[model samples]
Target: MNLKRINIPSRLKGLCYTLVIIISFNMIAPIAFAETTFEVSAKAAIAIDADTGKIFYEKNANTPLPIASMTKLLTLYLILEAEKNGQISWDEQIEISDHLLKISEDLNLSNVKLVKGSSYSVRDLFNASAIISANAAVTALAERVAGTEKDFIDLMRAKVISWGIEDAYLISTSGINNEDAQGRIYPGSKENEENLMSAKDMALVAQHLLQDFPEFLETTKLPSTVFAAGTDEETVLESSNFMLPGFYYYKEGVDGLKTGTTDLAGASFAGTINKNGLRLITIVMNANDSNGDGGLRFVETTRLMDFVYENWTYETLYPKGSTLPGFNKIDVPNGVDLSVPIITNDPLQLWHRQDMNKEHLTLTMVNSYEALDKNNQLKAPVERGQQVGELQVGYPEDTLGYVDGSKQKTSVPMVTNGATKKANFFVLSSRSIKNFFSTIF
Candidate 1:
């Protein structure tokens, strides 16, 4: 082979062009296809629908596990709620304390460099905490909520319990590791004070968040963000979730959720995607390869979500009001004769079962119609859903959905509606006698 010397500018141009092609190729081929399931060995992991707390897949779902900065969800929840309750105004300015001021100085960390005595609007602080996972921003929020981080954490616990998050513990506002075993602090205290949550509990937290703090969805969907750059040198926050664009499962509906990382917790992620009308939330914890890469978390999230979307198709079980024939309709003596609207308050959730065929059913109706008074308790021992009406609807033995199959009776939940009627002595005596006999019958 003969070697010829090339011009400097031309050689440089050719090298640059070749490098661009190589980079493009690598970027284009981000991840490969793999069989999807919930086979991850994470300490705890779960995937659910944010709108509906449907658990698509889970591993160690009820077991408590260390969650890194994903603790921000709780912090974010309290702050947003406080804002909603008029406790704090988004435009209101507030000063930072020593706790937040110190955290802002941590290098390469998500800090807005908020200065002491330098005031910021609640919105700014809110974005900083949520968008960047700024430790200082959340700590400041904690202080505002309950006068101190310790007390604020108690408030957070109360809120979590209200949302049904059992077994999850929040020790730090930012979920950063700290070794201080102070009595007042929540359990994340021994250089291991990351937020602790299980897949099931986290799902509960997420469900509550979606119901109340839906604005969080807007912030997390951003692939990148620019915050406080003018004041604090304009810190740019690129999303740590790389699966946003150009991924198979990732589409226009992918929005913001929390991500986590720690030596103990590994790379953790809780992400959500809304496609068409179906929305799915995915969680992965403790899937590290010792390479400092978030590959396992990414791969697991993708696999699990893909499995759920592909394997399980949401089917309509029993719809509202549509009656099962062969049942006698009671004559409404005074009220209008309309078929009492029979429906499930919530959809019947099923996994790995898909039969949807109709079968024989038996519906037992009890007279919840009592003298409706006050906020209208039925003035009886029976509560709202204590079988006032039951439809022993036939269900399938096994199917993708839990709809009726081979003539098996499934109890349906029906609630009583308050009545508006003039309660005279005769009406009261007749109803009381009817109720006593009905109970016995």
Candidate 2:
């Protein structure tokens, strides 16, 4: 039988080979890809786990740049620290310095119109600085704490250093742009200083602030409040942070943080959100005011928060009394029972990307044997609920090598489910004889 041979053009043959090669390359490649990344119109940004200090997402996080009014957070930190150390009292009256008043008047900077000869309580000043980003109130608070704005700035630098944050520099207590429209240093200050901080360092500062003075949230969360109520100089100061209530970008869990803006720094924000026992700190710096609406910082912050909340979720890896798979029991040597059921005493929760399914999850036990030889088996006298090991849950990559930037392992304490006592001498001897006979047979 004669077989007919089909003829094809050289270009068509080359195209067929190219298609086959491309198809083979795609088929051999791994199906899993990296998580989707959202676009942020900011110079730098970061999102961190407030509890663990784990970084979830970052862009130019370590590059120090002007943080604008966000510097008030550090100043607030100093004030709160002083209050905690008995160095300052909330109700103690603070006299506005002539220097601060002059700066407020000459520069026409953002202020609560603090009266020059007015003596406002520390609480009132704090409210103005925190809620409205009042420049004069913060400067006055700094001067009260450290005797001079320059000295207070020194303290701010020292505080950031003590927190192991090296990239931050404080020139003004209020984080106002110290340069003029022509980029020249504004006169009347001892030196030309601008507050520069990286997104990561800002997150660290915010974490410290939240942990140290969680009570500050009571003031920052307010959209508007009276600065000095029941007084002649009473003025209604409103929060510049649009993420709070009464603004369009407000979210239920968003509370107590700060916003910043200047020609140099544009718009920036150091925001925090607490939801379902998970608190996250997000910082976005130098976001553009694309629409000139004057809320780009808040808009970017809201976007970052939404992305994080949508892509990540908290799940209980192991619940109490749940026996670990592949490790249902542990051998209890010289005990009343041959083995005891190994179970977790407490639940283990892990924050991870939502795409990771439960079926792909893995758990590994890191056992601690007190008195065991080569086999590392448990000894008798094992009490119920006694911690014997730790169970770690994550993906295989996280469980094995624990790659950085990947999901972190959540470790749960494992314990014995039942009590076990030492076996009697007679029983031990009988078991030894039986083991020897069985080996011989």
Candidate 3:
């Protein structure tokens, strides 16, 4: 009665506006984002899966510098390949060549004591090079493979280029060039020259190695294995890398590779680790700045390993026998009803980013069709696990990887079990037996 009838709407409007003020405050409050910072200062390094070559974490991964003895991983890989291909037998005896002897004696950091003219098995040379950064052993193997250490070095350069390792150089196999010795030596002298690699390139090299030489783990993980000490058993070799300490994270399926040092390159390492069917390779290059040797390389490598084990994780993308959407249906020949179910090799999961969702990642298909080839013999849809298509995820650029992508496959014939039989005589009247496929579809 006190307010005029015409003013009632305006008064209510003001009250409504006032009521909304309380809700806006609740809506506009800031969210608390829990983020922790982990700084990466290594020149370049990366961690990745051995099978997929999926990068997990990286810093300066493409920056190629002197990788030190980490290059041995490549040398080792080629040598192993040669053995596998029958080009070189494990028992094939190789003598210490002049150049090899020179590298062995010159690299003061580590040596397998390649006695000139002394014969050793290819296996011995490979073992020495991998177990303890033996320049002599690596050079001996390199020279044997391509006829000279120089040629082997050329192969190394070409391979690095192929592997997308831009920042690395392989002037020496042992990675034993002395940084301090550079000032006094000539341009190409061992003292003046050096090997280079960033953390990322080193990791890639390790990745290639593990993929190429699955057997390398057997030798590198011996914790402490002796090699080629005949007549001088005094020189029992050990893993210069102390990662297998009385108690360490490396013990859990962490296997081999090479370790390196030199005043110029600092300490470098590359190796593989497999746990719970999840395999990954980690490389640390120039992680240690101290040439005098305080073992910071081990300390830092362990830290990187810790970050990987704790902060990062692996997840399957698509499990076998699973049906995917979009790809919910697949194309198969003589597939009953003209449509076959789509299946994947592994369960689809956030392999690279276990913390993210499958819906968010970009999924792409790898096109592989089974048609009549020049000679067709009723191939039963190419082996079951054959790659027909793949699902790849696009991830952020800051991290080293975007790996969860995997191969897709056409489902096995549903009617092979004899399910495609005509349900009724009435069905035969609609179309020819073969046309039934199109009609039902």
Candidate 4:
């Protein structure tokens, strides 16, 4: 074949080339992020509704495993509480302890070298621990809070137990192995012990931290910050959570959470995201990364995110002042009115899956009556908005339940919709006489 070629202007050729490149990129960008089949390789994982404690998904979530730096979340919780309760202040300056200084100087750990006799504010230490996962910075804060790291571990144990986590195995304050603590292990604990918690337990910790301290995201969302800013020892601290904005694995709506890695723990993450007003907390523990890049945790967490957003939606299941079928009105025989209408005190909002049938959701009236007569009727006068009992929303039989492994029901208070004044004495006496005569007949 023979063809004649015509030369084009240089400027026109460059413009054509640019347009082609832009068109090609636009075509490929959407495909790169399109969803595909995904499987989680983590030993344990869980995704939960941050506000409602609803479990959206789980895999081997109850088994205990090492959590690495994710343990700092609990430490941060205590520090915030201490500050709120007047035990500590963000501006309070703490003198560097020799023990923490040595750990800070160790090159093997994640830390910023602390100068002996130097003082740092609580805010700086917190930012370093949170943003950089600096172990010694957190350990210093732990010591300052509880007077000793061992005592802080005790406090951590007590706190988790109070949250209904019975199987937490805590050793060091920073989630490092006891051996890494330089012979400063917790009393009676083995040298190799590292902080171990099931995915559920970690989810509970994340849940509590986010719920109790919504302001925490203010610090966790910072991609980079200067520790000891405007000082001679100023150091830059970058977040280990790559899912935040402006990172390689960045996902929109991902703000504050924690990441962990160790020899025993592989790589793990406790991630949270707020999408369209619905916030979810996810935990992936011991994720295997063949590339050894420690990014598999974020990848697995993204899978959990996909599972939730693709399969579930957050909406109001029931409106306020609505009552369950057949249980709408409670018997109040002796009041001015014979019976009183009852309803939910608030709206019932929860996470729902795409394939889930609304008809399958069941509401059961819990037996928690405050005051009842012999026949189960309200004893007398009932006040408006008085809580009569609880209404529990039941999920499917095969559901995995909550991250905490507690009951799967989403409970709301059932209350009287209006007040019922006591009946007059004459009316009560007449009703009693009529009841007695009818019984005799």
Question: What is candidate 4's lDDT per residue for 102-215, written digit by digit as tens?
Answer: 888888788877898789999999998988888999998999999999899999999999999999999888888777887788888897889999998999999999989999
* Candidate number with the higher lDDT (3 or 4): 4
Which parts of model 4 have CA positions greater than 4 angstroms off? 1-39, 321-324, 328-345, 348-350, 379-388, 412-441
Better of 1 and 2 by lDDT: 2
CA lDDT, every model vs. true structure = 0.60, 0.74, 0.57, 0.80
Clashes of 1: 15
How much does candidate 1 score in TM-score?
Answer: 0.67
Winner by TM-score between candidate 2 and candidate 1? 2
Task: Please report the candidate that would top TM-score against the real structure.
Answer: 4
Looking at model 4, report the run of 10 residues with the lowest lDDT sum.
12-21
User: Model 1: per-residue lDDT, tens digit, 1-441?
Assistant: 111111111111111110001112244553332333348656678777565455556677777888877888888888888888889887887789866677788764556787777877777777777766777887887787789888887887788777656577777777776632223346445554667888677766766777787878787777767765467545676666666764443545567677787666778888777764667777888878667767777777777776666665544344443333433232233332222223443333223222222221123333333322233232332232322334333222221111111222233444433222334567667877998999999
Error of model 3, residue 38, in angstroms? 2.5
Per-residue error at 103 for model 4, in Å? 1.9
lDDT for each residue of candidate 3 in 132-188, tens digit (9 for 90 to 100): 777778777877888876677778888878876565656665565644322322236
lDDT of 3 at 16: 10
Instruction: Assess the local accuracy of residue 207 in candidate 1 as a C-alpha lDDT between 0 and 100.
Output: 66
Q: How many pairs of residues collide in each model?
A: 15, 0, 27, 0
